[model samples]
Structure formats: C-alpha cells, structure tokens
Target: MEILDHAFMQRALLAAVLVGITAPAVGIHLVQRRQALMGDGIGHVAMTGVGLGFLMSANPVWVAGAVSIAGAVLMELIRMYGRTRGDIALALLFYGGMAGGVLLTSLSPAGSNANLVSYLFGSLATVSEEDVVAICVLAAFVVAVSLGLRRQLFAVSQDEEFARVTGLPVRALNLLVAVTAAVTVTVAMRVVGLLLVSALMVVPVAAAQQLTRSFRATFAVAVLIGTAVSLGGTVTTYYQDVPPGATIVLLAIAVFVVFATLAAPLARRRARAAQAAQGAHDGVRPSPGTADDVKV
Candidate 1:
C-alpha cells in the first residue's frame, strides 16, 4: 500500500496495468500464428528508437512511439513486397534499427550512455506522470483497434489466404496486426523495458492458450496471467530489490513453464479418455436393418 503513496510507483502501476492488458491480448494472435519472433523483432526496433531519443535529447518513449509505428508499417511493406520470407525481413529491420540506434547513441556525449542503460534494463522508479499518460493512451488505442477489428483480425490470423479470398481485406488487416504489435511493444517497453519486453508479450499468452479453446477464453486467460506477472513483479522488485523488468519476465517464464507442464498431463489424460471412448464404441455393432424394416 505504501507503494501507492508514492506518485512514481502509482504511475508505474497504472502504466503496468495498461501494458499488462494490451500486450497479451495482441500477443495471443502473434503466438497463435507463430509470429513470436516478430514481437521480439519489434521490440528490438523500439530499442533503436530509444537510442535515437537519447541522441535527439527527447524522451525515449516518444521516440519509441514514433519510430516503432514506422517500423511496424515498414514491416508490413517488406512482408508484402518480399512475399515469401517475412521473417527474414523482420530480422533485417530489427538489426537495422538496433544498428542505427547504436550509432546515434555512440555519437552522443559520453555522459548520456547511462541513459541507454536505463532503456536496456528499465527504471520504473524513474517513470514519470507523462510516461504513464503516454503508455495509457497507446494501450487504449491498441485495445480499441483490436476490439473494432476483432473478427477481421481473427479471420486473418486463422488463415490469411482464406480471409483474403473471403474479402476480408487481408493485406490491410495484416498491416494492422503489425502496427498493433508495435504499439503493444512500445507500451510493454515502459514496464518491462525493451530487452525483456518480448517475453512479457509472449509467455503469458502461451500460458493462457494451454487452458483455453475459443479465442475469447484465450484472451481472458492471457490477461489474467499478464496481470499477475505485472503486479507480482512489481511487488517482488519492491521487496527484493531486484530489477523490475527482469523480475516480471522471470515471473512470466515461470508461469509459462508451470502451465505448459501441467497441460502435458492434461492432454495425455484427454487422449487416453478419447481412446477409451473410441474403444468402447468400437466394441458395439450396429443393428443391420433396412430403413423401411416394418418391425416398428
């Protein structure tokens, strides 16, 4: 409760809540579609923005917001143009952004290098009211877009070619997915920082998918897992004097491992029960009779 008394901590908590909600929501689709690496790529690109911010003497979050949007759009374009190996394109953009950011930061004054470290590791204690507001706004935007385009996004995620054949604007929706992921990465960066942000975005979603069937149920479960990690990490960091970002990432990984292990046994049990049901059914013979048999 004392953490709430401090304005900075309260801001961190608020921003974390927003990040927790949006990151896993978008991440569910990414993981389902096997685009987990794409989220990592986006987060790396965001780091380049962080470096650019330090170079420009502006807030890194603002730079991250702007550059990541462009990066996301570019990812879409590259995927469209390349037409086959989008993952390679994503990797290219990620490294290019990181290289550019590093170059910019190296050109900066010696004393400013420490600023980049904050971006690398994260400093929730340094989170400001403005940072909180920006994260909240971005998270809200991601949520609105996700909800508004849920059906189209779902169709696209399930099968892009099918969605396109069905007149679902697959290309535009794909771009929207990239952009949404970028925004989610930006928000996650604030809480978990760029390095571990990808884990925060992914692990919880993976955990949730283990327990759910339908898309809506998966989303709900993911949110719960993410929220738990965000809040638990906050408390752990406060009490244990650990790095908040790393703590949160580790928490998420722990959840993923626990759930994944549990799911294996559950899946085995289900398989066994299904096999038993089939065996029992196979033991029965159908009554052979014509439909018009007059016994009735």
Candidate 2:
C-alpha cells in the first residue's frame, strides 16, 4: 500500500486505523442514541484542555483527555436537566467550550498566538511519535470499554427504557456512553484536529448505517469507511499539497452524502410500495375525486 511504504505514510496509516476503529465503534452508539453532536462539543472542550496544557507547559494530550472526561460528565448532568432540550444543551456546550479555549489561548502570557491555529484548525503533519502514542493509549481504552460493554451499549442504543425494563443499569450505561464518546473525541482530535474531529465520528457512521442492518455490521461498515477516507485523504493531502484534516473531513462528507443520496430514494420507494401493498390488502376504497384519492 502507498500508505505503508514510507515512514510518514506508515504513521499516518497507523493513526488512521486507530482513529477509524475507535471513532465509529463509539460513534455508532452515539448516533443511535441521538447523542451524535456530543462529540463536537467534547472535541471543542478537549481543545480548551490542549490550550490550557500549552499555557501550563503540560502534556496536551493528557490535559485534553482529562478535560474531555470532565466535560463529558458536565454534559451528562446538563442532559439530565435538559432531557427534552438536549440539542440546546449540546449547542451551549460546544460554543461555550470553543469560547473558553479562545479566551484562554488569548489570555495566556507565554505561548505565541500561532499555537492557537494548530489546535483550532489542525497540524496533523506535525504529529509526533509521542502524540501517536497518546492516541493509541486513548484508542485502546475506548476499544476495551466498547467491547467489554457491547451488550449493554447495544441495548441502550436501541432503546434505553426497554433496556432498563430488561435489567440493564440504564444510568450507568448512559454515563458509559458519554465517557466513551469523550475518549473517542480525544483520540480523534490527534489526527483530525478539533474542528473536524466530529466529522470523523459522524460521517462514517452515517454512511455505514445506510448499508447495514445489524449493529455489528454497521460498526464494521463505519470502520471501513473511516479507514478508507482517512488513508485516501492523507494520500490526497500529500499529492495535492492540501491540509490533511480538511481533506479527510471533506472526503468523509463526500462518502456520507453519496451513500445518503443513493439510500434515500430507495428507502422512500420501498416505503411507498409497502404502503400501497398494505392499502391493497386492507381493501380501503378511495373516492375518485382527486388524483391522490384515486391512487389511494
């Protein structure tokens, strides 16, 4: 593979696989539970952590991971209070996190303003071995947690109330989802950066859902989609002299859009045909007054 031949290419490929595996493994649950936007919020929160880490001359990944965990806890609390207004809570979390990061970066006395650009947009080309190690550690944590709790995660994802009725610890599972999402966001931030990290979590999952019926199948599809886009986008970035993060995000968006376009009409047609067949079976006669009535 072109992505494995060179050293940098190999690193990028490794990072892509790690990111792809973790992002969608956690993302499928997030999307199924309607907490998809939580990644975007936590990513921005992790940026604030990175910024704070820089200001304190600390390890950015460690600080970002810690901050993401704390932020995720806060998100859980807000969701508890705003259950009916979940998106509003998420939007507040996102902008609040971004603004906090910006304010901290600006107010910091030591670091150059240029440091902000790296976190805000991305600097994946400058990814060091240490960063890759951090990514791997976080990714491993995410994977271990996901596989360990797969059944509960799957049950809660499909329907929390039903899962609770069936004896799953619903609250603990909810918090588990939030924590997993936060860790996934932190890992993804390394390769895709803060602004585009959520796209990595979201787009591939969306594309995969179009083609898969089982949860396991969907997660597998998502990982495949994620790995392909990450590796392909890295190659494109090298050849085209483009920003790696932007290229990867664009490629993911393209994949999701393509799959969604193809799936939508097919799903609609199937639904319509099913409805027509049901109507025929039900023997519901319609007045011959309007065209739709005649068809009905």
Candidate 3:
C-alpha cells in the first residue's frame, strides 16, 4: 500500500496488469498452433526496435512495436513459403535482430550498456507515463483482436487447411496473429523485459490448461492467473527489492506447479464419476449365472 504512493510504482503495477492480460490473450493462439516460441523470436526481434529508439532519441516502445511487427510478418512469410528451410531462416532472423540491437546500442551516443540492460531484464521503476500510454493502447488492440475474432483465430490456429476450406482467409489470419503476437511482445517488454516476455506470454496459458478442458475456460483462467502473478510479483518486488520480471515469471511457474499437482486428482475424480454415471445409465445387471436361474 505504501509502495503505491510512488508514481513509478503505480505505473509499474498498471503496466504489469496490462501485460498480464494481453500476454496470455495473444499467447493462447500461439500455443494452439504449437508456435509457442514465436513470442520468443518476436521478443528477440523487438530488441532491434528498442536499440533503434535509443539510437534515434525516440520512444523505444513504439519503435520496438514497429520492428517486431515487421519481424513477425517476415516470420509468417517464412512459415508459409519456406517450409524446407524455415528453421534456418528463423534462426538467422533471431540472431540478426539481436546482433543488430547490440550494434545499434553501441553506436548510440546517448545509450549505454546500462540502458540496454534495463530493457533486457526490465526496470519497473523506470516506467514512464508515456510507456503506460503506449502499453494501454497496445493492450487494447491485443484484447480486441484476441477476443473479438476468437472464432476465426481459433479455427485458423487449430487447423489452417480446414479453416481455409471453410472460407476463412487463413493467410491473413495467420499474419494477423503474428502481428498481434509481436505487439504483445512489445507490450510486455517494459514489465517483463525482452528476454523474459515469452515466459509471461506462454506460461500463464500453460498453467491454465492444467485445469481447463475448454478453450474459453483456459483463456479466462489463464488471464486470471496472469493478472494474479503480475500484481503479486509487482508487489513482491516493492517489498523484497527484487527484479520484477524474474519474480513474475517465477510466480507464474509456481502457479503452474500448483495447478498441475491438483490436475491429477481432479482427473481421477472425473474419471470415477464418469464410470459411475456409465454404470447407472447401463442399469443394474444380474450376475453371470445367479439371478435368472432362480426364476427357473
């Protein structure tokens, strides 16, 4: 409570909440497509944007968003047309983006290793009002795309071939997803850092899956879990004087463990209940040779 008195703390917590909501919102689709690491690749690419911002004396968030979106679109193109060498292409992109960021940061007169380090691992105390505004706008876009077009995105994510056959623009949707993911990476960068943004995006969704059987349920629970951990971690950092990014990720993992541990027992109980229902539906049956013989 005392921590919230600071303007920086308020901004950090707000950013954390937005990250919590938006990361999992975009991530669930990636997980559905088995492209969970796409966020990581985009995060890597976003580094170039951050560096470019520093070099040009611009807002890193917007620059990172632009660069990451371009990178994501390129990745999608590779996925669509470069199947034979997609992994190789992706590796190159990831590495190039990171190297480019480092190079640009080194060249910037106003930027230093310390400046880069803050974005790399996050610095909650450094979040500015402009950053919160950027994050809010970006988060709104992420949520609208993720939830508004859920059916179309889900169809495309689950099966591209089938979705195309059903008259959906699969390629467009795929690109949209890539773009949204890129935006999410940027949204989370300030709170979780570029290096760890993927974890926040994917882990909360994974944690929710342990307890949910339906996609909607998973989405809802994941967002809830994400929010909980983000706020929890933000608060923890205030008291413990630790890195917010690491604390948030660790808390998410801890929630996943708790959910996984509970899943096994819940599964067994559901199985037993299903068996009982089946037995009741079948009605009581006589033993092999006991009941019918008595009548005779």
Candidate 4:
C-alpha cells in the first residue's frame, strides 16, 4: 500500500506491466531465431545513445530509442552485406556496442558516468513521469509493428531461405524484427536497465515454452509469468533494497527453473497417456506407466 501511495511507484508498476506484455512479443522471435542476446546488444547501443544525449543536453530516452533502432538496422545491413551468420557476428556487434558506449560516456561529462550505473542495473524509483509516457508509446509502437507483420515475420523467422523462396522480402522482415527488438530494449531499459533487459525479453518466454507447445499459448503464458515477475520484483525491492532490474531477472530465472522442472514429469505423463490411448484403440494392453495405469 505504501508503494502505490507514491506516484513514482505507480508509474513504475504501470511501466512494468507494459514491459511484461511487450518484451516477449519481440523476445519470442529472438528466442525462436536463436538471437535472444540481441536485446543485450541493442541495449549497449542504447547506452551510447543515452551518453550522447547527455553530452548534447537532450532527452536520453529519445536519443536511446533512435540510436538503438539505427544500431539494429546497421546490424542487419552488416549481416546481409557481409554474408556473416551465427552468434559470432552478433557477439562481435554486441561487444562493439558496449565498447562504443563506454567510449562515448568517457568523452562526456563526469556526471554522465555517475548515472550510468543506474541504467546498467535499473532503479525504478528514478523512472520519471515522462519516462512512463515514452515507454508506453514505444512499447505500443513495437507491439503494433510486430503483430501487424506477424504473418511475414513468422514466415521469415521459421525459415529465411524458405521465406525467400516463397517471394517474401526476408531481408526486410529481418530488419523489422531487429527494429522492433531495438524498441523493446530501449523501452525496457528504463524498467530493467541494459544489463538485464535481455532477461526481461527472453526468460519468461523460455519458461512459457516449457509449458506450452503452441505459439499462442506460449505467448500468453509468458505474459502471465512476466507480469508476475514485474509486479513481484518491484514490490520485493521495496523490502530487500536491491536493484529492481536484478530482482526481476533473478525472479524470472527462478520461475524458469520451476517450469523446466515441471516440464519433464508432465511431458513423461503426456507421453505415457498418448501411448496408452493408442494401445487401447488397437485393443492391446496399455503400458505400465500409461495414464490408464497411473493416477492423474
């Protein structure tokens, strides 16, 4: 109750829920495409954007959004033009983004670096009223672009070569994905910071994937998990005095482990049940571990 009594906490809570809903929309694409770390990379680029904004006396959030989108587009271009593939390229680009941010911050005022740690680890109490508005607008934009192009995005994400074969603009779809991911990262940075923004994007989806096979179900389940993590972490931080971003990420990891552990037994039970039903339909004996033999 004390938490909600403050305006910043209210904004932070709203921001958390929005991030919980939107981060995974982009993350599902990243996780399925084996590009989950892209959020971290873009986050580093966003840090550089923030640094640049500080140097120029501009709004860091806007600058970070612009720089992050540009960086995302640039990475796609490099991958397309250089014919590079795999994590190696992304890894290189990620390091470059971080190095660039460090360099930019070094060149800026001393105070810029002082505030950098907050961006790295997150301090939701510092999320201003204006930040909530920016985050809302960006998150909405990211989701709209993502879902509007879901068909083509899904096609490309599934198989780039196949999407190209079918006459889809694979390159453009890839760029769109990167751009949306960039937006997700920049907006999420305000809540979870650069270091753990990837977790906000990837972890819940990873947990949900363990529970559901269908994309829609996985997405829905992930939203629930993320929302819980956001609200839980924000509240937990009040008592623990820990960084809210770290709290959320650690909470997500715990949730992921719980889901993963549950998955194995559930999967085994489902397999047994399926086998038993097949045996029964064929007029054969059900297996020993079949659902017919075991309590539900």
Q: Which tens-of-lDDT digit does each residue in 68-185 have in candidate 2?
A: 9999988988887777987687777777888877676666664565366656555556666877888889889999988998988999889988998999898888888888888887
**Stretches > 4 Å off in candidate 3:** 283-296
Task: Give each model a TM-score.
Answer: 0.89, 0.84, 0.94, 0.92
* TM-score winner between candidates 1 and 2: 1
Taking the tens digit of each residue's C-alpha lDDT, what string does model 1 give over 86-191? 7687778888988887777787654344466556666778788778878888898999988888888888989888998898888878888988889888887867
Highest-TM-score candidate:
3
Q: What is the RMSD, in Å, between candidate 4 and the native fold over all Cα?
A: 2.1
- Cα lDDT for residue 25, model 1? 82
Q: Kindly report which residue pairs in candidate 2 clash with one another.
A: none
Off by over 4 Å in 2: 1-7, 83-92, 107-110, 264-296
**Candidates ranked, most accurate by TM-score first:** 3, 4, 1, 2
Off by over 4 Å in 1: 83-89, 108-114, 280-296
Q: Itemize residue pairs with steric clashes in candidate 4.
A: none
- Per-residue lDDT tens digits of candidate 3, residues 40-119? 99989998998898899899999999999999999999999997988999999999999999988888867565387778
Candidate 4 deviant stretches above 4 angstroms: 84-92, 110-113, 287-295
